[model samples]
Target: MGTADAPVILVTGASRGIGKAICELLATQGAQLVMAARDGEALQVLATELSAHGAPEPMVAVIDLADADAVAGLFKQVFNRFGRLDGLVNNAGVLHEGLLGMIRAEDIDRVLAINVKAPLMAMQYAARLMSRTQRGSIVNLVSIMGVNGAAGLSLYAASKAALVGATRSAAKELAAKGIRVNAVSPGFIDTDMTRAMPEAAHARRVASIGMGRAGTPREVAELVAFLLGGQSTYVTGQVIGIDGQMVV
Candidate 1:
């Protein structure tokens, strides 16, 4: 176990993929983790695995971020358990892929709820929870879609773009309180999120990557780990892209 005084960081969507990788890496570094996801079984398994690896057993919150009430309850539970939060990784999001004209209004609304509103609600809680801390960090996992609008992802793109703006604004607003906020805009990663695409669509995405390959979840996890650690004390309010040269 790390020093009993080690800071606790919360990671959303910790059931698999990038969120899974982030929890694993941080756990190995001995950070106390509060892992939240919609999958209770997955969160329990991951928490157990981390505990077996010498990391503190993660506290699990199986709550849907799409619900505002649930978001509030999550923060309350966190504060009740940990007393304070040192970091929050807003990694939970959804993408309803389709051309704007083809996507349903409900699909668009759901995407906005998850990809945009959820993060905003989490940020609000983090801001309040971290207000008194001597220092804290918040990392939002954005995407290249936030910067370069994708052809068939109008709703997704708009949501992430809004997240980027929120990250920037949050950083500036909270800096004086010793809070740092930033984002990581990943290109094409070989996560379930991307793997669900059709073969042809996947190929097109691969071809667009300047590095000629998709990134691994572990790669993105490392960047997030760095941002959460004390090593990044001076870095905040910037969106670091880990696209393997895709978004130049």
Candidate 2:
């Protein structure tokens, strides 16, 4: 358990990759974690690992963010368990690539539900709680695909672009309430999702980066931590990209 005075943070998609890295880093800052994801087993394993390492014991929430309604349940859990939320990382997202003609209706629904709707609703819930205390920070995980526009990822790009807009608008609306909202738009991060891309597509992505390599999850997490932490208190309504110079 963290100290009673420790900050409480809710991280969606907390079982893997950038989400997992965010949890680990935030825990080190003495933040009590509400780790939400679809993978119960993975969440448990990570909670155990963090606890063993002397971080605060994490509360795991196994939920499929694709449901969209799950965001309400997650916020309820947070309020009932912790009574307050000091930070939120909306990191749960899905990426389905297909040529425009090949895209299915189901794919659009699933991707939008997870990537856009859930996060927006999560922000709604978090905003309510944070407004009460007059303190909070929210970091939305966006992507360069949304800004730079990927060929076969039109739907995914649209969803993320929507979030980028939401981030800025939320920041404006929430600023007077002492709540902040920002986005971290990463490009070509080395995660399981990206690794699963077809070889040629993956190579093409890497070849466009000025760094000549994909970024790491930890690097993205570091930026999120900064935005959530006290280091960047004056920052909000911004979409910061960590793409290593997308030369494309």
What C-alpha lDDT values do all the predictions have?
0.91, 0.92
Give the clashing residue pairs of candidate 2, or none: none
Tell me the tens digit of each residue's lDDT in model 2 across 1-248: 33788889999999999999999998888889999998999999999999888878999999998776777988988899889999999998888889899999989988999999999999999999998899999999999989878788999999999999999999999999999999999998999889999999899989999999999999999999999989999999999999899834
Count of clashes in candidate 1? 0
Record all residue pairs in model 1 with backbone atoms less than 3 Å apart, i.e. clashing.
none
- Candidate 1 lDDT score relative to the true structure: 0.91
